[model samples]
Target: MLDLGITGVQWYARIPGTIGGAVFNNIHGGTHFISEVVKKVKVLDKDNKIRTLSGKALGLSYDKSRFHDFAEIILSVEFELFRGDAKRAKQVAFEWAKRKSLQPPRSAGCTFKNISNEDKERLDFPTTSAGYIIEHILKMSGYKIGGAKVSTSHHNFVVNDGDATAKDYTTLVKLIQKETKKKLDIDLVPEIIFLGEFWFGNVPGCQGGGVSSTPFEERVVWD
Candidate 1:
């Protein structure tokens, strides 16, 4: 995965997916997610035919891609990058690492996407990070759903307090999403991919009728 600082351009190495999954998810890093950086993707179809998709052909938004609807496999991806200082990139990455360290270990990543800027402004909230919303809604510490609990250190993370099942984890996720929407009028989107069977099947629902589903494409986006 690539972490491209504030500039839109990034160079990536050490990622483990065939170019297909990357294109499908628009995999990216830092404050930016996958939708912003990808330029093109080469793919191999089910019949083993090779093709290249470029520009708008690769529909990307948030952590989603149009490739999710196709059965093609990705071979490689090309990304757009900007000229930038290496030192700044490293500094930004370091900051991200520090923030990530405060989250729960062995837990799914951020449980929701922050609301849009207009929505945040409407709510008079200083920021729209899902962690911030969850912290306010759940009150963070000591919150639990079966074997899953809100991280004492961070709200967006649902930690497995040992023996946690998919049900426990998913239940907590729904609860957080529900409460956040009720209080803030903003829907939260999940960042982590759910694997295997969940308590209510893959597309789990939130209180505000929001749903989180596994991306159709099955590929690793991180190294």
Candidate 2:
């Protein structure tokens, strides 16, 4: 985007994954969300037919989208952007990259979604951040299971300190959920999508069901 003299997506510089994945997850950075720039998307619907969906049809929201519930293949996407100085955009991206330098070197990014505003208010918490709850409330930073460890630098990230298997990662995630529920009575929702069948320890919305053989079956379609 910077090379193309486009702005508004500089926040994505610190985010992992493709643009389509960002849209699918409705990924956000700071106060800006990918959904803010989305204009429309072309998709292959469940009927095996092509369709264009825009606005509410996409069901874009915080760290969520219709892609979470529907089986569709994203073919292409149009984004609204502003013409900006490439030099300025690059500078902003560089700044964001440096600020996010604490991200775990080997991790899948944030493990849990931020608490919803409703939960935050109900819990009487000052912030809706799941990382804050993990690190401050539960005091689970640096907690480890097998080779998977909750990153001390950023509590939301679970890092693989080498030799960490898929089971190790899933086990650590379950532990986080367990501790959160036990301490705060809040169910921490996972942010990363599960690929294969794995243990989820009775986490709501994540019980049973692994990645399906069909690509369009409750899949994240990258445009």
Candidate 3:
């Protein structure tokens, strides 16, 4: 935002959700993220006490922040931004949004975060694009499971075209991971979070979704 010709932040404009989620996921566009502009954040800790946390105190890093799993409520954030030309800011944000629009309209942004440098070396993978491995090598773009399909536009996006369910998404995700692991000896971790229970047979509650949850059963694969 521009205030009397001074800019507060441009990065936050790129993210879709609230500031809390942005900080939690280290939401980024362009090269910087919320962590860069955030001066401090006020969070309600598990003890129900409101406390202010500085950026460094949160240990903000690439695609991660202390708030990721901590039991706390992010009340608000304080940002410190630089003053830049209005046209330049708009151009930057436009470029970022244009890039984001290339993915599936119904899908999550990126299913898998870029591999860390250390993990990349350990896995003997040369490139950072996990999507490349899935799309180029594994050839999984447009791969489908039930109602969900990997975005042909970008391999990482999982799109729900119709009445898709969690099972469809998870099944496709597992299939990709399994294939990638078998082919490249690399284990790809997901960036998206699973909110509800994931019943994948190995888990105790999941009996191929036939135990009780009828609504969830229709979505499971080969059940």
Root-mean-square deviation per candidate: 7.2, 5.5, 6.2
Model 2 pairs whose backbones collide: none
**Candidate 1: what lDDT?**
0.63
- Per-model TM-score, in order, reads 0.72, 0.81, 0.80
Query: Which of candidates 2 and 3 is the stronger one according to TM-score?
Result: 2
Best by TM-score: 2
**TM-score, cand. 1:** 0.72
Candidate 3 ranges beyond 4 A from true positions: 2-12, 117-127, 199-223
Local error of candidate 3 at residue 97 (angstroms): 1.6
RMSD of 2: 5.5
Q: Compose the digit string of candidate 1's lDDT tens values, residues 1-223.
A: 2343345433323233555555666666555655566677788977889998885786787777766556677787777766567566666656666665556786765566667889888888888777777676558655887888887777777888988887787777777767777887666667766544332232433222222233423221111
Residue 173 of model 2, lDDT score: 83
Best by lDDT: 2
**What does candidate 2's lDDT look like per residue over 1-223, in tens digits?**
6888889888778776786788888988778888988999999989999999985689897777888678888889989889988898798789778877868889998888888889899989999999999899988899888899989989899999888998888888877888889988888888887774354333445445553433322342211
Per-residue lDDT for 111 in model 3?
83
> Order of all candidates by TM-score, from best down to worst?
2, 3, 1
The CA lDDT of each predicted structure is 0.63, 0.80, 0.72
